[model samples]
Target: MMPLPGPSHQPPPLHSTAKRGRPPAPISPDAGPSHCAWLEPVRNALFTSGLTLDDLVVRSGYSKTRISQLLRGNDYYPSWEITFSVTRALGLPTRPLRRLWAAAAREADKADDWIKNCIDRVVHDGEEPPLPYQAFTDDVRGVYTDYARAFLLTDQRARWVVSQAFDILWVCWNTATASENLHRYAWRLLRSCVIARASRHQDGRPDLRAAVFSTRGIRDPDVPGHLVFFTELIDLLDAITRLPEDQMDVAVLQHLCGAPHHVIARILGLAPALTRAVDHHARAALEAILTTPTPE
Candidate 1:
């Protein structure tokens, strides 16, 4: 991963990119009605299995309404029992779905922690304090650094991308009211910045596979026996840039930036269901792109 850029090379001032008009309504930690990420996969699996909600109800011994609620994320975090029951009904492998469920659960826990910290600060310290900007910068920088390295393929360029993202965040912070969930909001800003930068630079160009192959161990280390791995990574990045803009945004935000569906929906001004649909299509597109034979 690339190192975070220092303060010297500041990104340009935010212009039309910041969407700086009528601040979005303050978001609650559990504000949205969107389901968890695993819900769509489960739904797809159920469809493939020729099963309906009624069939799920019968299989899980849960009412239609209850099953709907669990799948819709209407009850905030779904219970482990509910997830396990749904997994059984879907008749798919357990581990991947379990991992998604675990991630959702962890996000819920983080929300709860943010709420608790706010309460502690207000009641104990007598002021609702915002997290230090540096701390927030440090936390998000690591994730964006990995994402930048994966996409840009050079440490200097990756650091520039991350630096630009933070510059956007700083602009948003000064202009908009502090959201209740600071980290989530900051992430949204960074995501937008990265997407805009990637799109602007891509310019509908073909893959630079030749250039990438020629560089080899110069920019990124070869590690003696990892040539194939490095080649695949470059291919993946090239494929991601080729994805449709909306699909690419969804893929980057969900997988690269680690934003949940609802947050992604909010950032993109999209409905949660639509967001999930785009994500599903994006994954399929990426799979096809990755699996296609590269020209000799």
Candidate 2:
């Protein structure tokens, strides 16, 4: 307290972390919800390409802090410019990641609308506005390809699962207030429904081999002479259905639905490390089961 600092010697402002060439620190993973599913793939691509966060910052012309936020899913929704830049920097295929980014952005915008509507209804004591069916349907349609692929692999149950998911959503809209993120909630509900249906079908199976082979129309006309391959595929699906619930769910999400581990973790309310371990165990079990010959 003996001497006061001069203007030139004053400490830097708290918000002035940005520098001409220096990048900021990355945010911790636990900082926020990991809703952006495409981020993990971008991180993996960076690792595979031997690139660093600084490299991404430089290439994308975004500050290190913003890049970190987007990559870590700390941002509620990433912008298209950020997505394009990061995708370009990582040399990843753009279309799928773009679709995920777009879906997330739409959800974020809709979340704001939902929150406002909720507040208005509460303050005015008016009848809650009906949920926007068109917007909801559009959001579902965005990810339907992946969702259908995941459930269809088992027994062509995609149509049924989609219908059931929408029905559940309608019920939820009538009963519950708006959620923090409606799209994520709806997607998780859909996945849970699919998993429950798959488990119900697999329960109490004594001889999986007999049951799998006895099922009709397991063959694909597109593959002219790969009967053995088709049979092996069916056996693999049966093995997947036999896995413990956590492992089975992780496997279906990762492989069939093409979800990243972080996305699976968020959807299942699990830690990322736990999700990765479950997927690893599931893969190992599948390998063991698939390699073993079926009883004659």
Candidate 3:
């Protein structure tokens, strides 16, 4: 078959060919909705950075076509290496992007080994955590894991969240150390990791229904009493989730995780007085919620 003429009449270009580079193709329809969560932000970053395909090519060390493909979410999923390069060039924060990329990878059914390999290829500084960073991780790792486990209600998931938090913190060690509160910085990283994976309700608050199942061990002896206690616990937990952000965090870390007040203050980067006040308010609110009777 012979090729047809391109067009009856060519349309005007959006910009002068001299000044405009090839815009990225529309994001591939094959990409899942979950993938778009991270992909859209990446495209937005590129647009706001005012970087052209050629600029991305130069900074990301990938070809123009590859860079364009990555931005468009075309063909196969891009490895963490190229994605990280583009994001780094755009000066986006690595921590949240790392979580989003990992979620996209899982949605794409990328194997755990493949994900790790892709992440490992993106070296930071000397590709090793500094001595001080390592020491800090060692000191707080256990407590961080405990807090994650209590909030998430699963040891395996808690470990994964903690691992991801530590890896991102490792990448941003210099910035974390330079911050006014390293403990608080690391704590925020861990919290973000956990919450990113946490299931949510229709209203967008965390759906912590799994917490009820964690109390099953206490049901062995008194079935009736345990059921009543479980019902009350559910209402209490629901109330806790509705608390203001700082109060909610304080309640979860101090009451749910059984961490000391001073430790909670350090982890939250709050003054001890502020932390105590938040705890007091949280308790008062929970008490008011549970004690108030329902009207017919």
Task: Work out the TM-score per prediction.
Answer: 0.35, 0.38, 0.68
Q: Which ten residues in a row have the lowest lDDT in candidate 3?
A: 9-18
What is the C-alpha lDDT profile of model 3 across 183-279, one tens digit per residue? 8888887777777678788898886656766665344646668877777778877888888878888887776777899988977888999899999
Screening candidate 1 with a backbone cut-off below 3 angstroms (N, C-alpha, C), the clashing residue pairs are none
Model 3 score (lDDT):
0.73
C-alpha lDDT values of all predictions = 0.55, 0.54, 0.73
User: Could you say which candidate leads in TM-score?
Assistant: 3
Candidates arranged by TM-score, highest first:
3, 2, 1
Comparing 1 and 3 on lDDT, the stronger one: 3
Residues 198-254 of candidate 1 have per-residue lDDT tens digits of 434446543334334434453566466467756776676577767886787677666
Candidate 2 lDDT tens digits, 1-296:
11222355332221112223322344345432223244544554454455577777766677878877776666445555565666655544444444444444554564656434333332212123244844665555535535554555433466655654554454344222245666556666666555444334534532224333323344345555467656766677678777886787677566556677876776666778988888888999999888888799
Q: Show where candidate 1 strays beyond 4 Å.
A: 1-132, 178-236, 249-278, 287-296
Q: For candidate 1, what's the RMSD?
A: 22.1
Q: Identify the superior model by TM-score, candidate 2 or candidate 3.
A: 3
lDDT of 3 at 69: 82
RMSD to the true structure for each prediction, in A, is 22.1, 18.3, 10.3
User: How many clashes in candidate 3?
Assistant: 0
TM-score of 2: 0.38
